[model samples]
Target: MRHLSTVDLKVEQVSGVTIVHFPQEVDAVNAAAIRERVLRLLNNGVTEMLLDLTGTRFLDSAGVHIIVRAHGRSTALRVPLSAAIPEEGTVRRVFELTGLSRLVPTTIGLPRSAGPAASRSCSTARARGRGRKPRR
Candidate 1:
């Protein structure tokens, strides 16, 4: 099998929605960094967004925290923000427990971009830390 990169995330902006894809496991070790990078993107002016968790098989409370936080940010920013939780990932389980599934607009398939590409960047840098803001 081909090896995966050490990078835990990738950023892609299709149409208007910014898609942040997690390509590996997400535990306490890297959850914060993921959260920060996402928030940074939103601060940069991204509006509609989607968290692609298809490759992710694991996540902790911290991961859930970021999603919830992003949901609030999306509301305040008046942008559409949602998650794509795989049908059989551990992520769905956590969401079930927290009832986040109902609160956050989780979805499958890509959403139509609001318009033209707003921004584009595919960085390997997760940027460390958390506890600042949310992304989307």
Candidate 2:
């Protein structure tokens, strides 16, 4: 099993959204870790999540499962899940091929003028309107 060499989860408060920055390769070996972390945030009252996959280099079936499950759970809980994916990359291709690109809100690359920090702020504001608290 190929393990992720570096998996970092950073929580930032954006406008009203809790952006979970996932900077790691997501494969079979470490997909559970990502699931657990996201579940923890959901339990902590995160209703709006923005997954930033800017640094991810690879994604496998297990990784896709994790994302699908998260999306399912969010729907059941009435939460919103969005993602930031570059136009061209392994991760982007995986999502596209799996037909999950339509299921999740995905943006091509980072916001043009809005940096990560600013995006976080915008997300926070959006989350607030939905009556969801931003997770730390």
Candidate 3:
């Protein structure tokens, strides 16, 4: 039941999965902080992660870099990482253009089961997009 809030992110845990809510803008100014927080979570042995970016309106290269790094680390650690990107917006577009969505598991919005059932729901959603598309 760990909860942590920083100037650029809000972190919460749901059924052993870590969910990170991004701010409206994730640029060079706050990207490092966000990256560090994510690193700490991974180092803490987070089994799964959801990068909730539905509220993000702007994300520069540095912000994208943070996600990329996270994906790499998570993959190495065997921790599943997913993202909640809006249907359409700067954030989504950035992910698409960068081909990041293809690399990570992603859903249109925050997973419906952010509660006790999140573990099952997240896995199901990822399986749904496994072969056909990039859920990230």
The sequence of per-residue lDDT tens digits that candidate 1 reaches over residues 1-136 is: 2222344577887777798987567766776677777777777789678887756788777788878877887778787777776554476567666777677666433333522323222111211112325766
Candidate 2: tens digits of C-alpha lDDT, residues 1-136: 5344345567786766877776567776778778888877877788588777766788889878878888888888888887776555688677667766677877666554424422322232232234346669
In candidate 2, stretches whose alpha carbon ends up further than 4 angstroms from where it belongs are 1-7, 112-136
**Candidate 1 wrong stretches, greater than 4 Å:** 1-7, 108-136
The lDDT values for all models are 0.65, 0.69, 0.78
Tens digit of lDDT per residue, candidate 3, span 36-117?
8998899889989999888899999998999999999999999999888876678877877777777787777777676322
Please name the candidate that would achieve the greatest lDDT relative to the true structure.
3
Candidate 3 achieves a global lDDT of 0.78
TM-score of predicted structure 2: 0.74
Which window of ten consecutive residues has the lowest lDDT sum in model 1?
121-130
**Which of the two, 1 or 2, has more TM-score?**
2
| TM-score of every model versus the real structure | 0.71, 0.74, 0.79
Question: Clashes in each model (backbone N, CA, C under 3 Å)?
Answer: 1, 13, 2
The CA lDDT at 35 in model 3 is 89
